[model samples]
Target: MKSLNDIKNIAIILTLAYAGITVTFLTYMATSVRTYNEIITYKEHEINLAFGYLFLIGMFTLVVLLLFLFYRAITISNRLLQQADRASGNYTIVESVELDKERRANEEKMREAKLLFDKEVESKLTAMLIFSPENLAEDTAFLEAIMLKMAKEFSAVQGLAYKYNKTNKAFELAATYAYFSENVKQSFTLDEGIPGQVAVKKESLKINNVPQGYLTVLSGLGKGTPSALYVIPIVVDSETVALLELAFFNNIDELLQQVVEQLEPKLGNIYAKFLK
Candidate 1:
């Protein structure tokens, strides 16, 4: 296809050629009329003058027509260039939008896959705990194992299991996993902090924000506050047997929360037998 530049170049060359031809023809006619007027008879001079006037008129009209055609060509080329630029810009914008949509779709698929994997792991762990030998639930070592498993599975920064002390009328810390604090209280009354409250109410609570000075999370890096907390009460036979506390640097999502909730009933049965 001929480009706009090629067409413009052709139009310019034609216009210049027409102008040159017009100038050359006028010069030739003027010189011829001057020579004829000096050499020819008066009657012949008059007749030649009439012919020269007609030829001059015709050449002028032709020059005007060529100039008009050249101007029209330039105008058409400019319009075509503008349209091409606009089309190119629109194509770029559309391509960018399509890429963004594809990126978002890929991210969504990854998120869904991660959720499914987590759910499967949680289900398997629940079945394992439920079907274990009856002797495992009666030993202190089993309580520690359960705490460790819960902390690892949930990615908790710290985990504490508090068995209800009937003699002392308090919840005593029975097991700890990934915990770095020695200053923590050994036990809590039924009305004390969030854990105590969950034990009294016999309901689970998910806290997205922990108040300042309420709790401090310790790690090898340093000590800092946790962003979220979970207080779950283990109940069996209409009585609270133990309370489980978990702390994390990030907020827990709904899928993990649902898994934890499902595990509570089975844990309640195990803890009841172990605490006895």
Candidate 2:
């Protein structure tokens, strides 16, 4: 940019010089023509002819100088335009790089914050379950309390717990929360349905975009269908002893899943000690 400015300054100086020289030449030629006219009125014809040739030559030189100045102006203008284009391109590239860096920084910060939040939630859940006391002998009541607590924490529309009966080799409905039905399926064998599948696999399952009429959330005001389903199997000694199912109006996110995973060990201990 500084160099471009220098070039502009030089161009200005040359233009001024050209203008001054043109004016001086024109002034001198005008005076000479006037003097020659007075002298030529009485001087030889040959002198008049020679003076005319000199005037034509001077006019030609002035025209050539004007064209050269015009061409120089055009050249300078083109160079300035090219320089501006290059500068603009460089600026865009720098701006893009800065924007990318800022975006990456923000993403990293979000990832860190998410990890911290997940740990905090896990810690809180651990404290609540680990430090509290309860009557584990009353299995039905215990299941109900667990469902209610989990529902409250996750904002679930409904929750259910199915205890595995070793003799029948089937999952029987143990407790329910915010669930209403004329007849609920009370039992499921291995690989029977979503709940049974989780129980058989001893793994959790999350379903999004729940099929219509799959499950409904009932309140005093009205009823609405749940949009998601989460089925988690409680395993002890490599045996799935029970299953917990939760329905939600929104999709289950990673935080909720993480909370459940964190609670697995404590839940396993509780199930191992309390339930058969």
Candidate 3:
């Protein structure tokens, strides 16, 4: 559990201790020889024997210190290697996590794109079926079916279909779907309301932020006002034959707009047969 700094300090102390011991041993050897030769030539041999033992102890201590220093160095190197391995493992885990997140994001984007493509294809097929040559008719039920289909497909809660009355010179409601209001008007003059304006101009219109009490959608739970309205004029041979009014609770999305535009010409062709 000792830190690297503590180990380094211990090593330095051992090195200094070894140096001091070596210097002391050398000084003792030199002084003992000089003093013994000057004072007692006969005891010189005994002094040499005692100093030899001391030298032997000093050398043993130095060897032990060297072995301990070498062991400490190896232990520190192993600790460093272990730390490096742990760091590398953690880095690899983090990299793998990041790659997983990127892969999930890409998968979500692909799914969204696929859903959009499928919806577009379905809308086109519905348009083709509704405008088929064999299905062309002036029946009120037929007109209502078209209106209901469009309302559901475009997320409109309610819709009304009006056909031009040539003799009366006005637009008369031919069909109504998902409507519960009793006071709904049965007919409109060319200059009367939003539908009337589209009829006179022979153009399509989209209205947002509808005025309060302008129109309401009814269900078993309750009734609520719509936030947006779409008035599409069905023209055939340059003559406005019908006006389709749809009410939605939310703003129309881009995909719905594209589908509606694509249906315009085909709906016109179907309306032309109704004129006959």
Candidate 4:
């Protein structure tokens, strides 16, 4: 179909042509009336003048009618073009929004897949620790190895392993990793403190914002209080057998929690063997 602009142009051209023809015919009639007035009788001249005026009026009316039609056509075509442009703009905006949504969804899926892959790798590694040569020797050696592995994996400044002593009715320190304090508490009964609470509850504990004078981490340059503490109890057959404590300079996050989840079961099974 012809575009609006093309139709408007055609209408404009026709209007100008009709206006030019009207002007020419008006000039010719004026000249003819002058000629008739000079030669003819008064009555005939008056009649011819009336006929000439009527023809001129008819021609002028047709010119005005064409011009009005042309104006309406131009107005209609402009409105149609503006509507088309607005529709096109709206479609583009909708498409852009859809693309943005798709991109965000793809990014989320990729993040979830990476998390799953990392959890799998960590699970396999923690499981393989069961067959390590150092961990195969004895109970204390196994506990020490496990503490060391956990401290390194979680970026802990200090770690301690405590075993429940039936005769003493308390949990006694069995192994330490990166421990620097000589006056650190070595034993606790049920309901004594955080460690004792974990022992009694048989569940893990997480503490944040350790007090200023609480446990300090010693380094070559200086010493500072740890920011976070984790106490996990090892439960086997509905009985709490051992407890693990770790202190960190930073806070733990979801990934660390998942690592603990994977390692805890393996630790419980191996330690159960040691108990046997």
Candidate 5:
């Protein structure tokens, strides 16, 4: 009852063994033919008999050695191949937006939107990193910067983004791409909404139908339109400083997923700021 791995090893050993045996046998056979003629012509009885016995024993030994070597060689080779395959198995998920369709989505609009989005992300991240130590109490300034960027990218409609401040007990306007009532920027207490729950637990939460839930009031979002909202809490030094919230965007999560993987190590480098 050999294990699978053991059997594989044995197979390779047998292959090498056979190869070696075949080569040795062929070489011996060719030399023996000429030697046989010499033996008969010279009448060297003792020498001929000794050579004959030695040839037979050598053939037997070669066969056994060749079988052993072949199995070992192949088994080792197979195991190495399996290990190599495992090392390269990791893969990253890619968005499947059609290149032609997205390209034609609005060349000028897309170009402007991309530029705006890049500036917005850079702006937001830099501001948060800078203002985090100062204790950002209001979302007024931060959200406005993000919203301006979003508007430049997608002008068709407006978008809204928020962040939860557990200490302040409110949902601050993190970013918006459209105009909305000023009341929409109101904050909710720690015990008030799902954002608070997420902030406290330091985890993300999503609710599809906000009006039906008793969690918190969402004012000025243009009725029950933004049914889906994503709540992502940003932690600095293991403490939830703020929640980087976004609303009314279907593809934001996918984009964030990709960015998070890329941004993870980068955030680590910012440690150099504190070291010096």
Candidate 6:
């Protein structure tokens, strides 16, 4: 059904038609009364009655003209209504097409996201299932070998080692490998810096910013390039003994966190090895 506005327009056209009709009737009656009065006067020239009849004819003709014009206007309005309806339908079709395209685009994006998530899960699983303890020996040597293997596989940039020093209440460097150079300080003590902080707290440390000073305090592993570092400790018999540190290039960030998470469990039974 059409809205009230359309009905209102129709009502207005009806009212105008009524008004035109009323005017036409009033003009015809006025002309008849005037013609009668002029004919009754009987004085003056015959010219008066002739003129009055001509005026009456002209008024009647005008009423017909007005009705014809009104009819033409109604037809024009109907054509406009049809044009408007077609435009509205065209707009609706276009909107529906756009909605369908958007739905397909969103579905494609979701599929890609799921595939990426699955790939990452597979990568972590591969890293964790290296070897079962029943199939391999549980020794520090073996652990180190595993670490090395994983590092290579993961494209690790450096391997670091630290041992807690109860005597100085610090962690002392036991072994270190710097991929970039042989000249990197092969050893460091807790008194030296951040590695010590990790040792003192018995908590892992991950530094996102290798400030200029910390960068200068040591160099070579990632050079000034390691913007992030992870420190994990080796614990034995409820006492902290050693630490493992890895520095990554630029932002091996999320990957490093995953590596550390995977590394922690493997050290569960043999943490005693690095204490010596």
Candidate 3 vs 6: which has more lDDT? 3
lDDT (Cα) of model 5: 0.51
Kindly list the per-residue Cα lDDT of model 3 for residues 88-196, writing each as its tens digit. Answer: 7643577669868999999999999989877885765486445444335445655676776776666778888898899999999988889888988899989797788
Total colliding residue pairs, candidate 1: 0
Clashing pairs in 4: none
TM-scores of all predicted structures? 0.53, 0.61, 0.55, 0.60, 0.33, 0.45
lDDT of each: 0.74, 0.77, 0.76, 0.77, 0.51, 0.60
* lDDT per residue (tens digit) for residues 1-276 in model 2: 686577567667666665665566566556664555554564545555555556666567556766866887798897788678767864457766986899999999999998899787877586537423554666666667667777777788898889988899999999888889767789999999888778878888989999999998889999999999988788899889888898999998877787788777677778787754
**lDDT per residue, candidate 4, 1-276, as tens digits?**
367567568767766766676666667567774664453455756655555565676568667766777887798897788678767764357766986899899999999999887977677466536557767677778778777766666678888889889999998999998888999888999889889988888888888888877887788989988898989888888778888898888887767776676667777887788777
- For lDDT, candidate 1 versus 4, the one ahead is 4
Global fold similarity of model 5 (TM-score): 0.33
Best-to-worst ranking by lDDT? 4, 2, 3, 1, 6, 5
The segments of candidate 6 whose C-alpha lies over 4 angstroms from its true place after superposition are: 1-122, 125-147, 165-169, 179-192, 213-224, 273-276
The better-scoring model by lDDT among 4 and 6 is: 4
Worst 10 residues of 5 by lDDT: 90-99
Residue pairs of candidate 2 with colliding backbone atoms: none
Pick out the ten consecutive residues of candidate 2 with the lowest summed lDDT. Answer: 126-135
> Every model's Cα RMSD, please?
11.4, 10.7, 12.8, 12.3, 16.8, 12.9
lDDT of 5 by residue, 1-276 (tens): 267577567656655665565566566567665655666554655555555556566567566756765876798787777677557653223322454456677897889988887776665445434434322344444444434433343221344555545556566665655445565545555544666677677665654453443222234553434444555555455645454444543334433443443343343344323323
Ranking by TM-score: 2, 4, 3, 1, 6, 5
Which candidate number would show the highest TM-score if scored against the true structure?
A: 2
2 or 3, greater by lDDT = 2
Error of 6 at 204 (Å): 2.6
